[model samples]
Target: MTVYIDDAVHPWRDQRWAHLMADTLPELHAMAAQLGIPRRAFQNRRSGAHYDVPAPMRERAIALGARAISRHTDRELLKAVIANARLQYDATA
Candidate 1:
Protein backbone atom coordinates (compact mmCIF):
# COMPACT_ATOMS: atom_id res chain seq x y z
CA MET A 1 0.00 0.00 0.00
CA THR A 2 1.16 3.55 -0.69
CA VAL A 3 0.68 6.86 1.06
CA TYR A 4 0.35 9.98 -1.10
CA ILE A 5 0.68 13.70 -0.41
CA ASP A 6 -0.58 16.25 -2.87
CA ASP A 7 0.79 19.70 -3.60
CA ALA A 8 0.37 22.05 -0.67
CA VAL A 9 -1.55 24.73 -2.49
CA HIS A 10 -4.74 25.15 -0.52
CA PRO A 11 -4.61 28.37 1.43
CA TRP A 12 -6.03 28.48 4.94
CA ARG A 13 -5.28 30.27 8.16
CA ASP A 14 -2.32 32.10 6.63
CA GLN A 15 -0.67 28.88 5.52
CA ARG A 16 -0.82 26.52 2.58
CA TRP A 17 -2.04 22.99 3.11
CA ALA A 18 -2.12 19.64 1.30
CA HIS A 19 -4.09 16.44 1.33
CA LEU A 20 -2.62 13.25 2.69
CA MET A 21 -4.20 10.01 1.38
CA ALA A 22 -3.32 6.34 1.15
CA ASP A 23 -4.26 3.00 -0.35
CA THR A 24 -5.72 2.06 3.03
CA LEU A 25 -6.95 3.84 6.12
CA PRO A 26 -4.37 2.12 8.30
CA GLU A 27 -1.58 3.42 6.14
CA LEU A 28 -3.14 6.88 6.05
CA HIS A 29 -3.48 7.03 9.82
CA ALA A 30 0.01 5.63 10.28
CA MET A 31 1.52 8.33 8.10
CA ALA A 32 -0.44 11.01 9.94
CA ALA A 33 0.78 9.65 13.25
CA GLN A 34 4.34 9.68 11.98
CA LEU A 35 3.88 13.34 11.12
CA GLY A 36 2.70 14.04 14.69
CA ILE A 37 -0.88 14.62 13.61
CA PRO A 38 -3.65 13.49 15.93
CA ARG A 39 -6.30 10.91 15.00
CA ARG A 40 -8.96 13.54 15.58
CA ALA A 41 -7.61 15.45 12.63
CA PHE A 42 -8.74 12.81 10.16
CA GLN A 43 -11.36 13.92 7.64
CA ASN A 44 -13.85 11.16 6.88
CA ARG A 45 -16.20 12.82 4.50
CA ARG A 46 -17.76 11.76 1.20
CA SER A 47 -15.32 14.00 -0.63
CA GLY A 48 -12.60 11.58 0.46
CA ALA A 49 -10.81 10.39 3.54
CA HIS A 50 -7.67 12.43 4.15
CA TYR A 51 -5.58 14.40 6.58
CA ASP A 52 -4.90 18.07 6.01
CA VAL A 53 -1.24 18.86 6.46
CA PRO A 54 0.52 22.15 6.27
CA ALA A 55 3.12 22.73 3.56
CA PRO A 56 6.05 22.02 5.89
CA MET A 57 4.41 18.89 7.24
CA ARG A 58 3.65 17.85 3.68
CA GLU A 59 7.39 17.99 2.91
CA ARG A 60 8.13 15.94 6.01
CA ALA A 61 5.52 13.39 4.92
CA ILE A 62 7.23 13.10 1.56
CA ALA A 63 10.59 12.59 3.25
CA LEU A 64 8.98 9.92 5.40
CA GLY A 65 8.16 7.91 2.23
CA ALA A 66 4.76 9.29 1.16
CA ARG A 67 4.52 9.62 -2.61
CA ALA A 68 4.17 13.17 -3.86
CA ILE A 69 1.39 13.69 -6.38
CA SER A 70 0.36 16.80 -8.23
CA ARG A 71 -3.18 17.73 -9.26
CA HIS A 72 -1.67 19.35 -12.33
CA THR A 73 0.64 16.51 -13.42
CA ASP A 74 -0.79 13.44 -11.75
CA ARG A 75 -4.44 13.67 -12.64
CA GLU A 76 -5.14 9.99 -13.24
CA LEU A 77 -3.33 8.72 -10.16
CA LEU A 78 -5.00 11.39 -8.07
CA LYS A 79 -8.38 10.35 -9.36
CA ALA A 80 -7.79 6.75 -8.42
CA VAL A 81 -6.55 7.66 -4.99
CA ILE A 82 -9.55 9.85 -4.36
CA ALA A 83 -11.89 7.14 -5.57
CA ASN A 84 -10.30 4.68 -3.18
CA ALA A 85 -10.55 7.16 -0.38
CA ARG A 86 -14.24 7.73 -1.05
CA LEU A 87 -14.81 4.03 -1.02
CA GLN A 88 -12.97 3.77 2.28
CA TYR A 89 -15.18 6.46 3.73
CA ASP A 90 -18.30 4.70 2.53
CA ALA A 91 -17.18 1.43 4.01
CA THR A 92 -16.55 3.02 7.36
CA ALA A 93 -19.70 5.08 7.35
Candidate 2:
Protein backbone atom coordinates (compact mmCIF):
# COMPACT_ATOMS: atom_id res chain seq x y z
CA MET A 1 0.00 0.00 0.00
CA THR A 2 1.28 3.43 -0.94
CA VAL A 3 1.02 6.50 1.31
CA TYR A 4 0.53 9.91 -0.27
CA ILE A 5 1.18 13.38 1.17
CA ASP A 6 0.47 16.15 -1.29
CA ASP A 7 1.94 19.53 -0.41
CA ALA A 8 -0.72 22.13 0.28
CA VAL A 9 0.69 25.13 -1.53
CA HIS A 10 -2.25 27.23 -0.46
CA PRO A 11 -2.02 29.84 2.26
CA TRP A 12 -3.60 29.62 5.66
CA ARG A 13 -2.32 31.29 8.78
CA ASP A 14 1.45 31.50 9.24
CA GLN A 15 2.37 28.43 7.21
CA ARG A 16 1.69 26.29 4.16
CA TRP A 17 -0.11 22.94 4.27
CA ALA A 18 -0.46 19.43 2.92
CA HIS A 19 -2.69 16.40 3.00
CA LEU A 20 -1.67 13.03 4.44
CA MET A 21 -3.78 10.14 3.34
CA ALA A 22 -3.70 6.50 2.21
CA ASP A 23 -5.70 3.80 0.50
CA THR A 24 -6.80 2.49 3.87
CA LEU A 25 -7.59 4.04 7.23
CA PRO A 26 -5.20 1.85 9.18
CA GLU A 27 -2.32 2.66 6.87
CA LEU A 28 -3.22 6.32 6.95
CA HIS A 29 -3.27 6.34 10.77
CA ALA A 30 0.03 4.50 10.91
CA MET A 31 1.71 6.98 8.57
CA ALA A 32 0.26 9.90 10.52
CA ALA A 33 1.76 8.53 13.72
CA GLN A 34 5.12 8.09 12.05
CA LEU A 35 4.96 11.71 10.93
CA GLY A 36 4.12 12.94 14.47
CA ILE A 37 0.61 13.92 13.45
CA PRO A 38 -1.92 13.76 16.26
CA ARG A 39 -4.88 11.40 16.06
CA ARG A 40 -7.34 14.28 16.41
CA ALA A 41 -6.80 15.25 12.78
CA PHE A 42 -8.14 12.10 11.24
CA GLN A 43 -11.01 12.71 8.81
CA ASN A 44 -12.99 9.63 7.84
CA ARG A 45 -14.65 9.91 4.46
CA ARG A 46 -15.90 7.79 1.56
CA SER A 47 -12.44 8.15 0.05
CA GLY A 48 -10.20 7.47 3.02
CA ALA A 49 -8.57 8.94 6.11
CA HIS A 50 -7.14 12.42 5.52
CA TYR A 51 -5.15 14.85 7.63
CA ASP A 52 -4.55 18.51 6.84
CA VAL A 53 -0.95 19.09 7.80
CA PRO A 54 0.78 22.41 8.26
CA ALA A 55 4.09 23.44 6.64
CA PRO A 56 6.50 22.40 9.38
CA MET A 57 4.77 19.09 9.85
CA ARG A 58 4.65 18.60 6.13
CA GLU A 59 8.43 18.69 5.90
CA ARG A 60 8.70 16.46 8.96
CA ALA A 61 6.28 14.04 7.35
CA ILE A 62 8.40 13.99 4.19
CA ALA A 63 11.47 13.38 6.31
CA LEU A 64 9.65 10.43 7.82
CA GLY A 65 9.30 8.96 4.29
CA ALA A 66 5.86 10.22 3.37
CA ARG A 67 5.66 10.21 -0.43
CA ALA A 68 4.52 13.55 -1.76
CA ILE A 69 1.70 13.40 -4.29
CA SER A 70 -0.23 16.01 -6.23
CA ARG A 71 -3.14 17.31 -4.18
CA HIS A 72 -5.15 17.53 -7.39
CA THR A 73 -6.23 14.16 -8.82
CA ASP A 74 -4.13 12.35 -6.21
CA ARG A 75 -7.23 11.48 -4.19
CA GLU A 76 -8.64 9.69 -7.18
CA LEU A 77 -5.40 7.81 -7.68
CA LEU A 78 -5.77 6.04 -4.33
CA LYS A 79 -9.01 4.27 -5.04
CA ALA A 80 -9.59 2.05 -8.03
CA VAL A 81 -12.07 3.60 -10.42
CA ILE A 82 -14.72 0.94 -9.87
CA ALA A 83 -14.66 1.18 -6.09
CA ASN A 84 -14.41 4.95 -5.88
CA ALA A 85 -17.01 5.54 -8.52
CA ARG A 86 -19.37 3.25 -6.68
CA LEU A 87 -18.69 5.07 -3.44
CA GLN A 88 -19.38 8.42 -5.03
CA TYR A 89 -22.62 7.08 -6.44
CA ASP A 90 -23.66 5.72 -3.08
CA ALA A 91 -22.82 8.98 -1.40
CA THR A 92 -24.84 10.98 -3.89
CA ALA A 93 -27.87 8.76 -4.06
Candidate 3:
Protein backbone atom coordinates (compact mmCIF):
# COMPACT_ATOMS: atom_id res chain seq x y z
CA MET A 1 0.00 0.00 0.00
CA THR A 2 2.76 2.40 -0.92
CA VAL A 3 3.00 5.12 -3.52
CA TYR A 4 5.83 4.76 -6.02
CA ILE A 5 7.33 6.83 -8.82
CA ASP A 6 9.70 5.61 -11.47
CA ASP A 7 12.64 7.48 -12.99
CA ALA A 8 11.74 10.36 -15.30
CA VAL A 9 13.24 8.97 -18.43
CA HIS A 10 10.32 8.46 -20.79
CA PRO A 11 10.59 11.11 -23.41
CA TRP A 12 7.66 13.00 -24.95
CA ARG A 13 6.85 16.55 -25.93
CA ASP A 14 10.41 17.64 -25.31
CA GLN A 15 10.24 16.60 -21.71
CA ARG A 16 11.21 13.55 -19.72
CA TRP A 17 8.39 11.95 -17.78
CA ALA A 18 7.91 9.40 -15.02
CA HIS A 19 5.08 7.12 -14.01
CA LEU A 20 3.45 7.64 -10.62
CA MET A 21 1.75 4.56 -9.25
CA ALA A 22 0.48 3.04 -6.02
CA ASP A 23 -0.80 -0.20 -4.59
CA THR A 24 -4.33 1.18 -4.94
CA LEU A 25 -6.16 3.84 -6.90
CA PRO A 26 -7.07 5.80 -3.80
CA GLU A 27 -3.50 5.97 -2.59
CA LEU A 28 -2.31 6.97 -6.03
CA HIS A 29 -4.83 9.81 -6.29
CA ALA A 30 -4.10 10.95 -2.75
CA MET A 31 -0.40 11.27 -3.40
CA ALA A 32 -1.04 13.01 -6.69
CA ALA A 33 -3.29 15.48 -4.89
CA GLN A 34 -0.56 16.11 -2.35
CA LEU A 35 1.80 16.84 -5.21
CA GLY A 36 -0.73 19.33 -6.65
CA ILE A 37 -1.34 17.10 -9.62
CA PRO A 38 -4.74 17.25 -11.28
CA ARG A 39 -6.84 14.10 -11.33
CA ARG A 40 -7.35 14.50 -15.05
CA ALA A 41 -3.76 13.43 -15.50
CA PHE A 42 -4.51 9.91 -14.40
CA GLN A 43 -3.88 7.36 -17.15
CA ASN A 44 -6.30 4.51 -16.73
CA ARG A 45 -5.04 2.21 -19.40
CA ARG A 46 -4.93 -1.55 -19.91
CA SER A 47 -1.19 -1.53 -19.34
CA GLY A 48 -1.54 0.09 -15.92
CA ALA A 49 -3.14 2.93 -14.02
CA HIS A 50 -0.75 5.81 -13.45
CA TYR A 51 -0.06 9.48 -13.79
CA ASP A 52 2.61 10.69 -16.15
CA VAL A 53 4.63 13.10 -14.11
CA PRO A 54 7.16 15.44 -15.56
CA ALA A 55 10.80 15.28 -14.53
CA PRO A 56 10.66 18.27 -12.19
CA MET A 57 7.44 17.11 -10.61
CA ARG A 58 8.89 13.63 -10.26
CA GLU A 59 11.60 14.99 -7.96
CA ARG A 60 9.02 16.91 -5.96
CA ALA A 61 6.89 13.78 -5.66
CA ILE A 62 9.92 11.89 -4.29
CA ALA A 63 10.60 14.68 -1.82
CA LEU A 64 6.99 14.50 -0.75
CA GLY A 65 7.41 10.82 0.26
CA ALA A 66 6.90 8.83 -2.92
CA ARG A 67 9.28 5.85 -3.07
CA ALA A 68 11.40 5.86 -6.20
CA ILE A 69 11.63 2.71 -8.27
CA SER A 70 13.74 2.16 -11.33
CA ARG A 71 12.96 -0.04 -14.31
CA HIS A 72 16.63 -0.84 -14.70
CA THR A 73 17.42 -1.63 -11.07
CA ASP A 74 14.11 -2.48 -9.46
CA ARG A 75 12.52 -4.60 -12.13
CA GLU A 76 10.75 -7.14 -9.94
CA LEU A 77 9.37 -4.61 -7.52
CA LEU A 78 8.31 -2.31 -10.33
CA LYS A 79 6.54 -5.19 -12.04
CA ALA A 80 4.61 -5.93 -8.90
CA VAL A 81 3.60 -2.31 -8.61
CA ILE A 82 2.40 -2.28 -12.19
CA ALA A 83 0.41 -5.44 -11.56
CA ASN A 84 -1.28 -3.73 -8.63
CA ALA A 85 -2.02 -0.68 -10.73
CA ARG A 86 -3.62 -2.84 -13.41
CA LEU A 87 -5.89 -4.40 -10.83
CA GLN A 88 -7.16 -0.98 -9.91
CA TYR A 89 -8.49 -0.47 -13.42
CA ASP A 90 -9.75 -4.01 -13.73
CA ALA A 91 -11.72 -3.78 -10.53
CA THR A 92 -13.69 -0.84 -11.83
CA ALA A 93 -14.00 -1.82 -15.48
lDDT by residue (16-91, candidate 1, tens digit) is 9999999999999999999999999999988899999999898799999999999999999999999998888855
* Clashes per candidate, residues 3 or more apart or on different chains: 0, 0, 0
Question: What C-alpha lDDT do the candidate models reach, one value each?
Answer: 0.94, 0.65, 0.91
TM-score of 2: 0.65
lDDT of 3 by residue, 1-93 (tens): 689999999999999999999988898999999988899888989889999999989888989889999999999999999898887776464
Q: Can you rank all candidates by TM-score, best first? A: 1, 3, 2
Model 3: per-residue Cα lDDT at residue 32: 93
Per-residue lDDT for 11 in model 3? 99
Per-residue C-alpha lDDT of model 2 across residues 7-85, encoded as one tens digit per residue: 6786788778776766566777898888777888775555534777887777777777777766456656644422532
RMSD of each predicted structure: 1.3, 5.1, 1.4
Which ten-residue region of model 2 has the weakest summed lDDT? 84-93
* Model number with the top TM-score: 1
Give the Å error, residue 42, model 2. Answer: 0.9
